[model samples]
Target chain A: MAVNDAGAKQVATYWEGMVNSGLADTKAYGTTDFYNGLGSGKYVTYLAAGWGPGYLASVAKTTSGKWRAAPLPQWTAGGNVQGDWGGSSFAVTDQAKNPEVATKVAMDIYGAKNTDAWKIGIDEAYLFPTATPVLESDAFLKKKYDFFGGQTVNDIFVPAYKTISPFSWSPFNSYNFNQLTTGINGAIEKKTSWTAALDTAQANISQYATQQGFKVQ
Target chain B: MTQVETRSATAPAVAGPAPRFKRGREAATGWLFVLPFVILLVAFLLLPMAYAFKLSLYRSTLIEGEHFALFENYTQAFKDPLVRQGVVRVVLFGLVQTPVMIGIALLAALLIDHATSRFSRFFRLAAFVPYAVPVVIGTLMWGFLYSQDTGPLSSILHVDFLSSNVVLASLGNVVTWQWAGYNMIVLYAALQGLPREVYESARIDGAGPSQIAWRIKTPMISSAIILATLFTILGTLQFFTEPLILQPLNPGSITQHYTPNVYAFNQAFSFQQYNYSAAISFLLGAVVFVGSYIFLFATRKRSAL
Candidate 1:
């Protein structure tokens, strides 16, 4: 929770209210467990990755047509909100016998020229190619699923990805996650205030990053 | 000439010495017999340890290729808060879990050792079966049993067994159940090795079964108990599998840095910080070595008695 920034501070206040209202510790649930919980109506909303809906559908078959993808809520009215989760990038390593050929092959997989076809080849369940042309094409944008009541899911996500706040990862992201969760656990257990937890996490992460020879801010 | 001939006749005859070439060939054959094990150990264990140590001395990253940082990674590992906390948490876990586990094991070993019935063998096998189960499988089974939804524990106790507050105890229970039998087998073997005459003498001296167990058998087998304790301590400090498998079921309680080894593992694989991970691992190894030494030293006099 942010203490200095007014925008973040406001969101933090709202988050505190949610916690006070008995926001169950979501970390206790694994992917499958959470999916089961969702299907059982144990949770109202779940903030998830771009691929979350398709995954939910496969796991929670009985919950078809019940759930919908919506843009995340904003701290202030008319403000935009978006976040990114896990993803991998393709690269041609130095060990490649022909780097140019490797680069070309990598490019073709997600390139604008052939990405749409590749998505089709993968049966479209493996969704969300990051190629601009593929994303804007009718095939991708107009795709609908029975899971979300036949809504075009990308219509909600595409615009959301555009206004997402720019974020960078530190080399110590794993260590950062570990400390962050520990602080979160403390807050969830009611052993400490969320603000204190965040402060501690920030101090610990900065120290950790510095020790790892990173240019910590 | 007569005296010399008599001395030569009196001297014992000796067989010719083994051929030098044959001895050399025999030595080579012996080495050949052990060659497979030696190669495997060096390839798997020794080589990896050497490489890990070398990696620990360098800092590798996407931006800077790889550069030797000397002891920089080790220093960073020493300073890392997560490493410190994880080590401390495991030490606490070891302190509590090791004693209880060993106590249960000693009791079981004593009971089985003294039993005259045919069921003793069955009971011994039953006690040891949990240890035979793979750690991941055992932990997962325990995870299911601890589940609030499907497990009977929550309904019976009206409390969440896998919740943040009680998850550690739940994990401890799993470890104790799995390993107490293992330590019991070791202690039980030692009990079997004890001379029967001591117990017979104790019986003649009006010593009851319980008395003989505590005053005679227990003290004689103190060394085996210490060995069990040492292993338990090391195992506890290096605790990873149970928590890791259970993490998915209860992440809030068991974070990535739940134990030192887990922290090191996450760092190396998840974060791709192999150098730092190696450093953390060596630090943990150092702790384990020193801890074991101190324990053995502390118990030296008692075991001597």
Candidate 2:
């Protein structure tokens, strides 16, 4: 991480605003409280990836038709550079007993030519259209989701997806995540200044990377 | 089981005479009865521990190929601030929580033991009910109660229980709530088994109810209290579940390495450092062992003071 203290603080302030505003509750996750809170209108917004709305529809029963798809709120004015939190992938491993059949099934599941497969994958399973055919399909582009009050969410999402910038990943992704969380958490708790927390995280991650024999720039 | 019993019965009949052979036959039957348990003990406990010890002796690194690095991981763990800080924090937590829990348990047990009303039965059951609830579930419940907004306790008390300043104590509360009931049941059972005549004699000696409880009853159950203390100490040293469960709510307070067991878990699963994780786990085991040993040694005389 570059350890941009001001940027980190801005991010912290944004989250703190929600928590302070009583819109977001930092309640423990994986509990009934977590699930029921959002459904009960305790949480106004759920931030997640392209596949997130599908999951929201399953969990959000009362607010089904009240929802609308919108672009993520920008951290900075016109800040279109984006990141994602979730995606799905498929593979036919060498361990498969019938590798040829497995490959065919896996490829056909979202293959460009398989309209029926795309229908099930896109309309029913709520998968993001990855194939070009599915992306250009009239049904996909114009379809109105009842959950979002019959809005064509593809109008918002298809363009939003293209806004994502190239993100370089670290081999030590988990370490980076832990350290970043610690820094942000410390900033949120007001235990340390954002700069100090970020500096400490930067130092720690650098030292760890060095220990793992990565050249620290 | 019947086949083994039949075999044992037939053994003495075929081979040996009555007197000295009785001992051998009885020993064989005892071994037969314990064979399954011994096998499980070796397979689950001893073997896994042995493998972990082996793992602790080696570090597999990206640059350096896997090789014997005897005590290197141990040395690193000893100096690791996270490990030291976590140990000190937990030890302090145990110092506070263990006694508070045991004191509460003993008080509850004594009150129930000598209660005059029918409500005492209900109180005893109520106290024991938390023990029936799983620790994770109990922690989750407390997490809700501790939430700053939704929880009535927080709104009423005007405190954020999961705040960094107080989260450690908050975790202690969860563990105490979960285990106090179990300790209460143990102490209560011990209290029930005490001879009634001792209390009668104490009363005749002009001892007040409080005096009788503190002087006579407490001393009588010292062994069970010590046993419970040992268990609580061990549990406290390896504290993980509550902190782990509540981490997401207060991420900074309950950092990945907030406790030794949680640290080991993060190191092994998150960082993929199995060797270092194993080393830390064993070091924590040593700490727990030494902690209990010191307690037992200090109190071994059991009133010689």
Candidate 3:
């Protein structure tokens, strides 16, 4: 809920400054040229998800072993701030003919019940399940990817995922994200400062939150 | 809703005061022919429009709950700086982009019509190939060409096409590129329909190809040009696709409320403001309709003129 009040100002300022100083690529990544740019060394690092290896491996075959993973530097040195992406949930639709059976299947597929489902998920797609037991398991920890020179990269991700600062997710995430992007982009264009952008986002999101019938300070 | 019922509903209107018995068969047959289209139109466009209109009159929120808000959403939409900015942008875009596109199409059509070379055939197809490419794909291609790191032509063109200041013109350029060829084909078809005797008469008066093209062919194709202009204006008024496609590439330049259509989508999907979204969409529809109407009415003239 906090925008300008949070360290968002710091994060926004840092990246926005990087872009304005020409220290960052203005071009968006995840494009066709992105992979080629990687091979050409246009990028030194890619801020990718924990499950990025499967996708990265297919596109970045030429630079397979050269890749390395590292934690994002904290704004506050030794700060525990961390986040994740691509979190998903399963649901049984109300219209499902066998809702009860569908529910059980959904629960068991990646739920706490069995290792087989998760084992297949990891082997196939590099899915990072939220199961603490799975995270602590030796097989999960030992699994190595040739892309990162067989580094047990989840060792980096698991701790980071575990200590991800507790926060209530805004129901209006899409609006918040859109405003954030707009602000960040404006800052990148040097039309506004990063802190100014955060301030704008703060006002915009707060107003929008109030409109959605939520009390905001 | 069915054939018999639809025919019955249509019967009184098509019936005449003096000639009811004689023309009833002919009118009934005509109505029957149009029945399928009427059914489809009612099923799709009108019903959805009515529902959206109903939604626009109400407000629904987590705290406020659902209630009749009358014209509150419409009033808000009108006053919304986002909506106003988007409208002003599109109108400006329409004023510039539409004319340029139509002129290019007209010129291209005239030249292709005049040329008697086999290469003209190739040129015609080449011009039309952009039209064949979908808008989404064409914008993507342009996005690549405008990319600083990877675009092949960006440096050579000497324009930072994706920069916020230049992005509207860049979008205009893309739209003009997309539609010019299609409009050219339409105008060319209209040009082809003109009698060859008109050209013969003009040439007999010592009018050269340029004179014939300007004095003879151009005026003759004004109807087609107007039609093309109308379509382009409507297209521009509802401009969404290129901006939507290009937004991610240049998020700094393109905001969520970059265009009215895009704003409606953001409201409905992002903010869960369905009522506001409906209001925005309906207001945009009014703009498109009223804008096109004014153009037509302002330009309305006797066919002979």
Candidate 4:
């Protein structure tokens, strides 16, 4: 039932590790199902099924006290690359009173030296800092704790930051994605044909694009 | 001759002199009293509308080096399918959701007004609590509640109410839930304003509560109902945030062009189709204006008879 390939690999690793460690009785679920199960306290502990700074933070702060964070178990043979789940960027508004000063201050706050602080803040605040230098700092890099069985999350996250793809966010992205997601979910719930849902969604999005004057294929 | 003499005797009294400078001063005082409001109206309301109209006619993408294209945006919007869908969706939404919402509000108002229990005040406040919550927060709360995984309703119903096919209905539910209380308060106020004597006379004639409500109460407060209907219609036409936030739960349920306002927003911000966005906005405004006029005319006709 797992939809994501990377996520399935992660789950397989966790299950295999559990079986080897004589924890075969334990059951595992996808990240989506796991979070849903959290409210009911059905699982002993939940390991995040995917890589992401945001997911890392959530896994680190388990209310059940049984949950912990760890480096995602590898997928490929000798696979070392990590991936991000979600992140956001900051921009200086054109209307800002002092764009240069504002940019400088923003850089300092989000930049490398502040990595540990940002990580700590993110741990506490759930706000991910995107600056690389700060992400690689000792404060972020050397962190070790009982959380995630004492694994250093920064070791994985800081390295993954470099490999992260730069994503462009359009204002239309929120609108377009929303419509698409809603349509998909509706199809799933109603037990309607997926093709029909997709066609409807495509038509809706295309119509939207055309209205917004975007050339659609 | 006698009549003429009498008229002459009263001529000075009949020829009352104009109050001249004092009346002019009183007129000046009246204008002075209204000047602050007039200034504020012009500065805030009138100016922005005029500016929006001007902006709507010209294309000014926030991007630098962009030149103005007059009426080109409007023409392009007319050609956009998304804009057309948004308009169609909103019109349909207004047609479907507004009446249902107002009807529920009216029923609730009547129920609370006629409730024989002492807890009517509590009922009124409980119903109105949704309005007190900010719309964004309220919608978000509903979003979570409609969520397949986390929402309590979904868990209880064992169904994903926020799924794509039914999400519009779900959005309608949230809108109805949030505003029903607000509209109820207005209708209830109108109901209370009805002359007590009419109800008393109805009761003396052995007329039941329903009879009184149907024959007397509703007719007396029809104006309030019409006003609420108009407000709901206008509000539904400008639907945005509910669908926008709800979009996250069901991706394809609402598209960028699901509503006219969202369409205009995406054009301006995403595609940089500023002229098209402007044109769409003016078109939406015009739709609302014409729709309101039609609604007002229909209600006036209904009330006239």
For candidate 1, lDDT tens digit of each residue in B241-278? 99888877766677878899999998888778899899
In DockQ, how does model 3 score against the reference complex? 0.58
Tell how far residue A89 is off in model 3, in angstroms. Answer: 3.3
Q: Residue B53, candidate 2: how far off, in angstroms?
A: 0.8
Task: Give the candidate number with the greatest TM-score.
Answer: 3
Residue pairs of candidate 2 with colliding backbone atoms: none
Candidates 2 and 3, the one with greater DockQ? 3
TM-score of 1: 0.81
Return the DockQ of model 2: 0.45
Ranked by TM-score, top first: 3, 2, 1, 4
Model 1 lDDT, residue A209, Cα: 60
Query: Which candidate tops lDDT?
Result: 3
Show where candidate 3 strays beyond 4 Å.
A76-79, A92-99, B1-19, B302-305
Each candidate structure's TM-score, on Cα atoms with residue i matched to residue i, is 0.81, 0.88, 0.90, 0.69
lDDT per residue for candidate 4 within B1-305, as digits (tens), equals: 47545654665565458556445655665676799999999999899778777777665432333456677777777887778888888788878898899888988899998995869889999999999999999998887677666667877888767555676788889899999999999999989888889999999999999999888898888888888888898989999889877655554455667799987887677666656666788889889999999889877955532
Which residue pairs in candidate 3 collide? none
Q: Please state the error at residue A87 of candidate 4 in Å.
A: 5.0
Please provide, for model 3 over B1-305, each residue's C-alpha lDDT reduced to its tens digit, 9 standing for 90 to 100: 48767766766776656476637766777788899999999999999999999999999987878999999999999889999999998999999999899999999999999996999999999999999999999999998888766788776887778888899998998999999999999999999999999999889999999999999999887888888999999999999999999887777787778889999988898778999999999999998989988888877771222
Model 4: docking quality category: incorrect
Q: How well is candidate 1 docked (DockQ)?
A: 0.26
Q: Which candidate comes out best when scored by DockQ? A: 3
